[model samples]
Target: MSQAPRRTVVVLAAGEGKRMKSATPKVLHSLLGRTLLGHVLVAAGAAEAEQTVVVVGHQAEQVREHLAEVAPAAVPVLQAVQNGTGHAVRIALEAVPEAAGTVVVLNGDVPLLRPETVASLIAAHESAARAATVLAAAVDDPSGLGRIVRDASGGLARIVEERDASAEEREIREINAGIYVFEAAALRAALGKLSTDNEQGEEYLTDVFGLLVEVGSPVGVFVAPDVEETLGANDRAQLAELRALLRDRVNTAWMRSGVSILDPATAWIDVTVTLEPDAVIDQNTQLKGASAVAAGAVIGPDTTLVDTSVGAGATVLRAHAVGAEIGPEAVVGPFSYLRPGTRLGRKSKIGGFVEAKNSELGEGAKVPHLSYVGDATVGAGANVGAGTIVANYDGVRKSRTVVGEAAFVGSDTVLIAPVEVGPGAYVAAGSVIAKDVPAGNLGVTRAQQRNVEGWTARRRPGSKSAAAAEVAERAAAGAGEVSEAE
Candidate 1:
């Protein structure tokens, strides 16, 4: 009986990352939506690997915690000391337990490496039937990287680290990407012969290629299609560069698939966000974290949506929404805040400067301009006017307000909860409502109009106001006298 080949992946996430200038582990640093190591593990399918061993050192426990959440099946092996890459992999393999099939080793810091690239490397490694394969990239500036030295037949001769490279070798445009595939048995054998005799006084993983070359075992090289994928973030500046590359990739894909991104540079879309065809994303927008926009929806110019859904034909302009749902053809904001639990039905409107929290607005309902709606329900065709407030909180607890269908809540009105306005009711402007308004009734709470003449002139006594009032009074007296004489 032929057994399926077992594949193992070893991730090197053990660097201290002193260049990053932080307490956090290098692999734990996040950009876009995922940590550096999380991205690598996902790209490599480490979770589904027959076996995965993660080598952790600096902040090992923190990295272990992250692995538990993302790739629970992965086995973590602590390298208590900050050793070299060769030493880290040597320790990681000890935890694998399997001595046959294939072993893939990769650095966790290269978050931009794609799954397709990884698949290609493994395929190339097996097809060549070599003892080991090293992924290489020909970059414009290979200054700090290890240069790839090719033999007469173009097979990998050796990798020369920059610090130890001769002037001619440093000029080689092709650099080692620090990603590799090796036959399990061959990798285990080579690691046993590694020594910490390098300039850095650390065991160099690239040294294994030299040992294999001496033994006359062939070494393979797979040049990556995209140099950006071979990049690793050593500091904050490099991390930002990686982030920009990823952002461009995601935005370009969305644009190519019928979604319109008005300005790619200004718009930041998370990898998890989904956009259907005909969706338009305007400048300075950020769609993040499980958010979805259906076809014909237009979002942005300054909007940010996190964990929210925008329905078909909906328009969300200059708004910030989190964990909310905007229904089909609905209109939200020029400056609105939508908190978690908000739901707007079809054709609803949440106008400029409105803030909604834990509320539901039925179809055709509107909370227009400069209002706060919290813990409330507004029925179909209801209109909550500008400056209106549905006060849901008392001293101790929160309550809910209900506005029935066809109800008109006037501007500057405050509907104090546990209250309701019945169907077709009208709550007048400037009212402070404590009780419910019955069907077809008008609720009025403001005091009756009272006139205290010359109040501005008497109380304020401003020179400009007093002068204007005196002149107006003289003109009125003159007109009255002239009418009497006629």
Candidate 2:
């Protein structure tokens, strides 16, 4: 059996992206949970390149750090200056061996470029045995792009950048998509001949097409099936457009897989976000990093969840949760906030405006409207009333509260932690319990009421409150006289 060709990929990620107007590097700008360069790197993996080299510039240190996390297999080479695309690719190729075959060169800004597309390009290049093949796309607005100029035989003759092209050449709709596959030896030989003699005083990668044709080598073009796949973002606005396109693509796929996305345009689901069949995604919801919705789970008409998991048949609405686990049949929100470490059990309910963190609510437990349950655990069948507060922090240290099974915590009560509401205990409404309430006991802590005679009249003479008190006292005295007569 013959040995397969040694494939290599050189990813050019050296641009400063001045148009992005961000303190962070352009390739680091994120969308759908992945940075621009990260998406390209994933697609590049499709080619199964034996050797992968990433050229970094303009915040090279940051890019390298991120590469260490996302693409550890790839080698990082610094293009110390913002020379040009050609210069970047040349540096990357230099890091590889001389005999490396079927080298794929690409820009890191094109996030939508799919892996299958990369595979197809490599297949086309190798099967034709061409010196090079340019990935081309026919875009409606080809402005600011390098136009693809073909010869009489309909083969790629040359690539002309917009600045250097004549009016007729600029009118050509087919543009070079800035992705290419080159024969290793041929590319190395051509790079040495490149000069900064273009309109921009830089070594234009487009010039290499003309050089290859002069040597009587076959050069070809692979036009993209989807034009948007070859698109790259230059600014925030363009990035938004790309994100919308990606969102549509992702949501549509999920819908096809039996996930109901009620409003595809408004629902932004990350590419990494997973949803099982029969899961329903409502309008204006964003399911972000590490989020998964089990079958029969319904997520938001308005919600944002990150690193959270919702179990089967659970309902989460208008809630913002991060790093939380919601069990099956649990109901949350209509304005709830679940912070990190929150775990709700089956059939539990966290109602309107409730906020919980570092807490665990057992099965059948309930924390209804206007409550904050933090650093606490509510036992199964416990009912924590509306407006209840678990005071877990006391300035010096954070403590915990444990409400046992079948406990009844009244509305507007505060459970001062280091305390426990024992099983079957009843906490009176509007009470603040600082000590533990034992099983089956009624815990009530409130100051005894004392009504001082004529106090209101003395305190506020001639005031509306004094007038009302005087009338009440007169009516009481009259009633007393009638009782005496009887």
lDDT of every predicted structure (CA atoms) = 0.92, 0.93
Per-residue CA lDDT of model 1 for 1-486, tens digit only, reads 976657889999999999999999989998777899998998888324588889998998899999999889889999988668999988888876664688899899999999999988988887788889999999999989999998888878898899999999999999999999898888889999998877898888899998999998878899999999999999999999999999999999999999999999999998878899999999999989889999999999999999999999999999999999999999999999999999999999999999999999999999989999999999999999999988899989999999999899999999999999999999999999999999889999999899998887888686888889889999999999999999
lDDT of 2 at 193: 85
lDDT (10s digit) by residue, model 2, range 106-176: 88899999999999998999999999999999999999999999999898889999999999999999999
Winning model by lDDT: 2
lDDT score for residue 445 of model 1: 96
Clashing residue pairs in candidate 2, if any?
none
lDDT, residue 21, model 1: 98
Q: TM-score winner among the candidates?
A: 1
The C-alpha stretches of model 2 lying farther than 4 A from their native spots are 1-4, 453-455, 461-486
Q: Which 10 consecutive positions of candidate 2 have the poorest summed lDDT?
A: 91-100
Model 1 off-target regions past 4 Å?
Answer: 1-3, 46-48
